[model samples]
Target: MATPSSPFSFLGDLFNTIGERLQPPDWAVHEIQNRAVLFLNHVLQQEPEAQQRLLRQQGRVVRFQWRFVTMELVATPAGLLDLAPAGSVPELTLTVTDDSPFDIARAALRGDKPAVQIIGDVQLAAEVNWLVDHVRWDVEDDLARVIGDVPAHTLGNAVRRVVGALRQFVGSRTAGKAGGSAVGPAGNAE
Candidate 1:
């Protein structure tokens, strides 16, 4: 008896309430953003080529947007990322094309790329694409540094297995939603 928009409307209201309740203080949000930048720089450091690319992009800014969230990052000469100053214009902007965070997470878990809309500089976009295609976090290596190599290897393997299982389960559920056959990201039955 419920209308098609009912569920979506409920979800929207629920998210709004949650967002209002979970909103952090300005300082805490700034700190979290700084930490994210540090983590990104850490990952960038792992790949010399990526670092070099970023270095080449020094002084340029890239704005990223995912629905209501927005962050503008500036490329530092040291091949690191820093939060851009307020009101700074970005050389390029990357907008996540997907509206659903659940779908984005599922696609990421499946090792698939989320759709994006690129605006502005082509060179900057290409450099960003290269960084995305190349940079990866070596979680196992970091774990090994904290714990031990053997434990880290075992943990990493276990995590990978669990992720694989989840991917399969989620994929199957999505397929079921699409009439019992696997559906591509483009909604094509596969």
Candidate 2:
């Protein structure tokens, strides 16, 4: 797992099942690519460069001579994957990954979400941040709806797993902070 957790069995079992379901089948790679790429292409309509590249691929992949232009919708052993464009992960500039589709969806559903915000001392790039800021979490529902057509229902399950895992993470953090003062800073005081 990319993130670690205590032995408590909050979401581990659920996420494990979701991961299993998310792996594209041996013959389903093409379908998976079509679905994922098309959604991304639609979302990226504002970005002409990426949209052009995506259109050329028929919602699968297109390899241009330049490394920057070639993208592979590869289903490697590490689950469904996409070789995104260089600027795809603009949020990496902050090195914080607290955001997730589930979080965005819940926040927006509750009507307290903002379109954009600054963090620390960094100014997120205007274009990329603008894209992020404009992307509504309802789009997440759209993605999930599209994935519903797939035989495996991978994205749907993954979203559920993510929400469950996040709940577990919050519970763990709360339990640790609320109960650990009695044990002092370290787990033990030799």
Candidate 3:
């Protein structure tokens, strides 16, 4: 008889095979990175303190690495970030140390920071850390700009409730997986 995990394992392997066969083109990757930079700058613009910090570090480049992917961004004089020119050296580099995507996603869902190794400028590192810790995307406000305040608020509340339920479910599953027993909402183990 097939185990409960067999289907998931097969799906994972299938996805990996597909991913290996279909690598995104360079232009597609570059466009995606540019979009990410634009989104990041939009969020940064909403936070004056974060913008000021970036302004102070203007012209400094930060490189982020996760597995095979790398992104290089430089702080601009306007207190925004832009993709660093190809072949430009970064002043600082941060490499994600955790190898498992599942573990990284779990940590993110738990509001925990993923492990990373930082190399180079300490001041720049500190500023970046501060930004990570304090700055948040104002998703509801952005939604309100499109859908109006009341609908945005309703949607935000709905999202929060769903996220809360998901967190609880994931937490329970994690605990159960670690303990070798299913955990219930009331904290009972079976």
Candidate 4:
């Protein structure tokens, strides 16, 4: 008897093919980068220690690359991040090692950091690592500002549960593949 393949297995290949062939326009990429910078600044502002740490690295550029996309950000004197000017040389470069979006997403959902290749200034890399270890966006607080505290808390709990379920499901699937035993949703080997 032959095992059935997942219906969604083609999605990974489909996405990779599309990504390789279809590059977004420069203007759109720039706009998205600007918005990302804005969001980063907002999160940094919420953490005073993070700001002070970034302030220590003022004017230093950090470049992040994943596949074909890259973004460079410079630490400002005010402790916020801004998009680095085009052609600006970076003190540190961090490239995500994962080539597949599905793998990256799975790792993230499992609360694992994607492997990264770091090159450049040691101190800058340390600072970036510290920021990564410490800085997290308080989505619940942001949501509370829009909706009420109770609703935000409830929504946050719901989302967390859903994410937890996804993490378990992904973990089981990975384990089943590796161990050569199919694991059902209830986590029993079939």
- List clash counts for every candidate, in order: 0, 0, 0, 0
Between candidates 2 and 3, the lDDT winner: 3
- Residue ranges of candidate 1 with Cα displaced over 4 Å: 1-13, 20-22, 180-190
Name the lDDT value of residue 101 in candidate 2: 38
Candidate 3: segments with Cα more than 4 A from true spot: 1-16, 183-190
Better of 1 and 4 by TM-score: 4
Residue 39 of candidate 1: its Cα lDDT?
A: 96
Across 55-101, the per-residue lDDT of candidate 4 in tens digits comes to 99999999999999999999999999999998899989999998878
Ranking by lDDT: 4, 3, 1, 2
Worst 10 residues of 4 by lDDT: 1-10
Provide TM-scores for the models.
0.83, 0.30, 0.86, 0.91
- Which one wins on TM-score? 4
Using lDDT as the measure, which candidate wins?
Answer: 4
Candidate 3 lDDT at 112 equals 78
In model 2, the clashing pairs are none
* Residue 184 C-alpha lDDT in model 1: 58
Clashes of 3: 0
